[model samples]
Target chain A: MKKFLWYFSVTLLAIIFMFPFVWMLLTALKEPGTALVLSLPKKLTLYNFKKVLFEFGFSRFFLNSLIVALSSATVSTLFASLAAFAFAKKSFFMKEYLFWLFIASMMVPGLLYVIPQFLIVYKLGWINTYWGMIVPHLANVFGLFLITQFMRQVPDSLLESARIDGASEFKIWWRIMVPLAFPIVATVFLLNFQFHWSNFLWQLIVAQSEEMYTVPVGLAMFKSAHEEAYTLEMAASSVSIVPISLLFIFAQRYFIEGITQGAVKG
Target chain B: MKKGVRDNINAYSFILPFAFIYMVFLFLPFIYSIYLSFNQVTDFSDVFGGLSFVGLKNYLFLFRDKEFWWALVVTLYYALIIIPLNIVVSLLLAILLRKRYRLNSMYRTFFFLPFVLDAFVVGIVWTFIYAGRYGLLVNILKPLIGGIYETGFLGNAKTVMPSVALAMTLKGAGFGMILYIAALDGIPKEVYEAAELDGATGLKKLWYITLPLIQPVTTFMVIIGIIGALSAFAEFYAMTGGGPIVYKWGTPLGMTKVTGLYLFNHFSNLRLGLAAATSFVLLVLALGLSITYSKIQRKR
Candidate 1:
């Protein structure tokens, strides 16, 4: 039946789509030295993940990633929301010009900024420091831009009422704008969180010490350094894969919408 | 009407905190990079000491740098393949899933799952898949074609970029599929019903209705894809480390060293002048292509 064919095709595609993740689990569970030819786990063990955690310092890397990603996403969202409030609701001279300048600056590829920024950071003695990992990226223009777009839809009458109630701009932003824009900001926060979680290049450059490496950079370093240790490497990546998959499952709706909005508007 | 000074002060206060830091990290770099491109600094400390103006020496040097040209070619090849392939694959998947069906959301989530994983994580996963002698892909294909994929595609110089490109396309299609699905859902059902009433067949509806309606989304995806291809780094670092050198016109070239890695190499060596120039050139190329593409689209 045509109906049967439809379900069959979709189910097949879904399985194929999930094949790598399934393989990742299988590979992670396999005993060390298990042949790649063995599609199924042979005497499944957490030995590989344990090796990565204990020997390769994956726990340290995960903690570092969590600290950096959590702080950066939260701080960046706070700053961006404040700025977005001003842009959306306030009357300021040269505001349009200045905002355009900010947006236009984004057109210059981020690669162009790395060298100079690194030089400046080095001059300031921030290299190999957590400040190196966190501060330089806190003002992501995309986050500001996304929050601004969401804030503009916030009814001006609501803000006017707050003003009439003698609420200060900061208080209004905290009390009213915060609640009103909470949904979008939450979405953007998670997006930024995932983004920082996956940040490999910046983390790679900044982390001179193995102790400082974030999850992505640590996973990468683990791979190249322990080249033949396929099972261990698979386990290391599974660390990232598991959390992200869980994130996708729990926040799938926001991610689906947030990612799409960031795409089309961005 | 006379504007109040209070509004201006309040606005500046709110904006300056971010604007100042953003300028220090972002805007200042934009200008300094251009200046750095014209000056030589051999060490990171020397960058603080002073920059010796060399005019366009770095640019001239880059012009003759075979590695840079090869990187440019590799980038172009990636864009040429990835841009179209990503858009088409995602678009086809979107069209297939356009109709409301059982487990549609599950299907979409599965498709979009790979995109949620970081590029480096995905790269590691693919490296396992491409692990020459001990690869899932190799194991699966070995029975059909004996030893052809014995070592795996990533290790082979000729196949490395293509191999990376294939992995990237597979992971990347999910992102664009979400974009297309959203775009498709936005198209009014009345429009389709009207088309059906007009005797517009399936192919006709797709060509005249779906394609044209989603043209803007397509353009946006292409521009983003082009920039992505040009600036590809994390995955390459994780997957290839920009290695498995091939002899391109007798020059030892990294088969997968796209522009991003090329710049990273320069940065690591403290060749700030060259790195700055390369970034400038790439910035221009990216912005130029984006402008040109948009202009072309506007004209049409």
Candidate 2:
């Protein structure tokens, strides 16, 4: 009886939670209309998707987002791991001070970096370029900080053995620490990818060219430009939803682990 | 202790790539933003040599600016509601799902799906749901409210802030839910079992035991919630475009212009110095809130 009650409440809540996505799906399948009502399409079709994908060039935006998010996540996670290895395992001069300095940077709201970041990219004439999207955000203080905490848990005896066996410091980091800390690295990578993937404000500010737009920026622009074409806009948002939703479904463990670990340890 | 400067140098080499990039992109720009905030620049074309410094005028202007003050109050009113409501809702949901029930993972995923989504998507979809005329809320729930259909909250002067705040709260509650679930999982079964033996059950156990035990996670969530609330931009942009109808709303506040959106508008208008000052003010508030709450969180 208690189990039934539990299931009832949870399932009810879940329906409320999942309703928007379902509505989006339903909206995407229906024909464009003057008024959007919540109901199953009388005749379902892929016309909205076809229109959004082909005419509005959301496919290009998707690819742009993929390239930026994928490369940015990889590079930032690698950099963070490399620095994390140093902080976690090495006895470098001013290591504590430097690590704290990085952590302190995390407290600075990302908005603070926007103006100067834009200016620097503009100065270098990198605006509306891939470098403008990717390079400026590679210094992820949170990623470095999170991975450092994870790396500190790696047993020193293993590092000692690797060092004794004539492994160079770089080799040890490349071979040992990276492999052992791969879980946290993956977690950080996924987190970073999500940030870049859904990033809007910076891309909106810097990417004057439509060719450089990421998915969120494209979706936002699509919303305004096609305000009356609600079905087409729904299709654009639905396209944005699929990748992240799949990422959440498959890799939710790592994502939630990273967040909870932040609460407990970081 | 085995000590060679050589060993340290070798370790430092691993950190060099990150340090160089961090310095140029993040650290340098941060200092430059402070410099830019002191100047009035008409054009961002010559970022270096084109600006004449206006000293504290930007700061002073913002202090005297009614619209800026309105944004701050709306942000606070937005934050004050979102922080507490989200913390409660997510906590209640997490605690309710503490047991290893069937389909709990499915429930967890459904609840947390919003956190993973772009706020743009959430805002857009929810805007559709609250579309006043054709919205699900009106079509489905109108009878519940005696069929009184208006612009709903999205287009109202009095209710737009809370209306957007509600959507944001729902989207964010999932994040805190996941954190709370993790904290709940770490609490051993024996403690709860003992409480049960002592005749504490249901609400008694929750109030006396669960809340106190999960205090750290609660604190962490609260601090994060505050920062998230203050920095909210994309949602307001997507949903309200920063206003529906502007009024003083009884608190010297307009409806929905948040600090992030205000700063964003300034940036778009090429008011670079004022934008920088806004960023500075936002940054200081964020840091202050995080530090204050985290300090209190650690105290217990």
Candidate number achieving the greatest TM-score relative to the actual structure: 1
Local distance difference test scores for all models? 0.84, 0.84
lDDT of 1 by residue, B117-156 (tens): 8988888888878876667777778776454476577888
- Stretches off by above 4 angstroms in model 1 are A35-37, B1-3, B143-147
Q: How closely does chain A match the true chain A in each prediction, as TM-score?
A: 0.95, 0.97
- How do the residues A74-114 of candidate 2 rate in per-residue lDDT, one tens digit apiece? 99999999999989988878988988877888768788888
lDDT of 1 by residue, A210-244 (tens): 99999888887777687788778888888887887
- How does residue A142 of candidate 2 score in lDDT? 89
Q: Which 10-residue span in candidate 1 chain A carries the lowest summed lDDT?
A: A33-42
